[model samples]
Every structure is written in structure tokens, then in C-alpha cells.
Target chain A: SAVISQKPSRDICQRGTSLTIQCQVDSQVTMMFWYRQQPGQSLTLIATANQGSEATYESGFVIDKFPISRPNLTFSTLTVSNMSPEDSSIYLCSVEDRGEKLPHEQYFGPGTRLTVT
Target chain B: DQQVKQNSPSLSVQEGRISILNCDYTNSMFDYFLWYKKYPAEGPTFLISISSIKDKNEDGRFTVFLNKSAKHLSLHIVPSQPGDSAVYFCSVSGSARQLTFGSGTQLTVLP
Candidate 1:
């Protein structure tokens, strides 16, 4: 298990503006992932951030809208650009803890609640 | 198409009773299934998980049962407590290692 924290726990922004959420882990991790949970909806994976590579985004997400930066093994940032009311959601970051076995578990950060008005 | 499905949007159970949450997946290639609990304004917390090779896995009061043939899985919480009230999500992952989540079930444990 890993202890994770996100900055600006909750924020309200105007539409067409942008906000960047930061995630920091207590320990170094190889794989970090970003997720979004819309109101009354399931969590959707936004992108995967590795220490030294370009982030891999899910099908519906684009880099221009949600750019990610992984400067090191312990830190990553996700910026929601040109926000819209539809983009209001809780964004979370998770790290995969790989064990010697087949099943690996992920530990998550508390999440950043963003509301666009 | 939605790969994962959790039909029940909400469930209410009395304290000290049982709470059951069901989930189904359309893809047979998925090898891992997991359950997560979420409180308001918080991230989803890992509850339990089971591999495709195993029929069941237990962790404390939470147990996850997987049926690969039917592409179904369920989570059972015994002796539910009021603190257990939260939104539960069912997530599945395949070889790609990215999780696909079901639309969550909000469980309310009435005291």
C-alpha cells in the first residue's frame, strides 16, 4: 500500500478556464494513473503516467484537453484545460503496487474535486 | 459498448445484516476483478479482488466471488455496519492492465 496526496483538494473554476491537480506519493512508484468520476457515473481512466515516458491516454481522452506531467517517480500532475461544466468531476490518481504474484493492487490518492461553473 | 455493468444503483441494508453487490462484464479476456468503496468527496478505496483462476477471495468482512464462465462477480459484506455505507464500484482489468469500472452501487447501512 502507498500513501498518496493531492493538492487543492477541492476547487471551483469558471468554464473555459483550466486547473491543474497535483499528486504526490510517499514512495517511488513505476506506474501512476489518472481517473475521473463524473457525477452519478463510473470512474473513467484518463491516462497512465510513467516516470520517463509520454502518458498513454484512454480511448475517449485526448492529450490536448487533459495534459499530464510526470516529473519523477513520486510526483505527477494533471491539468484540465479549457474546463466546461461537463468536466466537473472528482479526479483521482492511483499507483500500482506489484507483488511477486499474479494479482497487483492499486492505491489511490484522496482526489481533487473540481467544479466548473 | 460498456464492458462492465453493475445493475443496482443503490441498496439499503440494516446494520448487522449482509450487503451484496453484483457485477457483470462483457469481455471474457478480463483476468482480474476488484471491488472498491468510496465515500463522499473521497477516492475509491480498494476493498477486495479475485483472479480468474480463483472462485473466491476473502478479506476480513468482505469477500469477492468470481465466476469466469458466466462473466459475473459479486461482493458480499457480512454483518454490515453503518460506517459501511458508501458507493461501491466493480472494476475489471485485462492484459492491458488498465481498469474498467462499473457505474457504482450506493449502499446505505441503516442503523
Candidate 2:
């Protein structure tokens, strides 16, 4: 399992402000993903961040709103732009670890809890 | 529409007993399934997973059973512990490589 960490464990921001969440992994990985967990809802994939490439976003999410940056294999960031009360949720970062003998597994970071007022 | 569903929102079980959590999916393209456990203020942790080729997979005290025909899967924890009190989520992966998660089921193991 990989050790992943996110900055700003919890934060509260006013509407119209942006918050950038940083994700760092202990080891290098090929794929990193961002997810959002709304209150009373399951996790939703926001985008897939690959090193040296533009992030691939899932449906219902656009890059303009949730921009992702992956400068290298072990680090990435997700910025929630123009925050709104509806955008309040827990943002998570995950990395896929493909081992040589074991099956591939995804590990997650303790998410950043963002509340917008 | 919700492709994955966990009908039960919460469940309470006694320690030393078995705890079963069920999940159903509507998409037939999903061939990989995973279970994740999460506590308050923490991210979901990987627990167990199963492929479409197998009906059941076991890791220690945790077992995951999958039924392709019913598009249903269940996670069973034997001799439940109080520390296992957390929310469990079922995730499915198709050809897209990304996972789709079901609404979690909160499992409370009471002493």
C-alpha cells in the first residue's frame, strides 16, 4: 500500500474563492485520481491525472471547475474553482499501485474537507 | 441513474458475530469489484476485491462474494470487531479503468 497525504485537512472558505488541495504519494505511480464525496453520497470520480498530460475528467465535471495538475509521478493538485455552498464536499486523492506479483490496488489519502459559505 | 446501489444505509451487528453488507449494480460491463472501509474524517481504505472470473474471494476474516447473473455482490466479515465500525463502500470498475462507487453502508459493531 502507498502512503498518500493531502494538505489542509479541513478548511472553510467563502463563496467565489478557490481552494487548492495538494496530494503527495510516497512512491511514484502512473495514475492519480481525484474524487469528491458529498454529504450522504458516495465517492464520485472527478478526474484522472496522468503525469505530463492533461487530466481526463468524468461526466458532470469539467476542467474549468475542477482543474488538476500533475507535475510528476508522485505529486498532484486539484483546485476547486469558484467555490459555492453546493461545492462543499470532501476531496480525495488516490494512486494506483500495479505490483509485479500482486493484483493492482488503489490507495487513498485522508481527504480534504472543504466547506463553503 | 445510480449504476451501483447499497440499499441499506446503516447496519448494527454484535461483536463476535457475522456482518454482511450487500451491493447491487445495474451495469453489466463491470467485471471488477472492490470493497473499501472508511471511518469518520478519513478516506476510504481498500479492503477486498474480486474479479468476474471468480464467485468468491477471501482474505483472512473478510470474504467477498459476487453473482454476475444478479449483478449483486456482498462483503462478509466474520467475528466482527468494534474497530470494524465504519462505513463500507462497494466500487465497480469497467473498461474505463475508473471506479464507480455505491452509496456506503455504515456498519456499527456493538460490544
Model 2: per-residue lDDT, tens digit, A1-75? 899999989999999999999999999999999999999999999999999999999989999999999999999
TM-score of 2: 0.97
Q: How would you encode candidate 1's per-residue C-alpha lDDT over B1-111 as one tens digit per residue?
A: 889999999999999999999999999998899898999867888888899889999999999999888999999999899999999999998998888999999999999
Regions more than 4 Å wrong, model 1: none
Measured against the true two-chain complex, the DockQ scores of the candidates, in the order shown, are 0.84, 0.81
**Per-residue lDDT value at A93 in model 2:** 99
Residue B29, candidate 2: how far off, in angstroms? 1.9
Question: Candidate 1 chain B: worst 10 consecutive residues by lDDT?
Answer: B40-49
Interface RMSD (Å), each candidate?
A: 0.9, 1.2
**lDDT of candidate 1 at residue B60, scale 0 to 100:** 93
Residue B78 lDDT (model 1): 98
RMSD of each: 1.0, 1.1
lDDT of 2 by residue, B1-111 (tens): 999999999999999999999999998888789999999988899999999889999999999999999999999999899999999999998877688899999999999
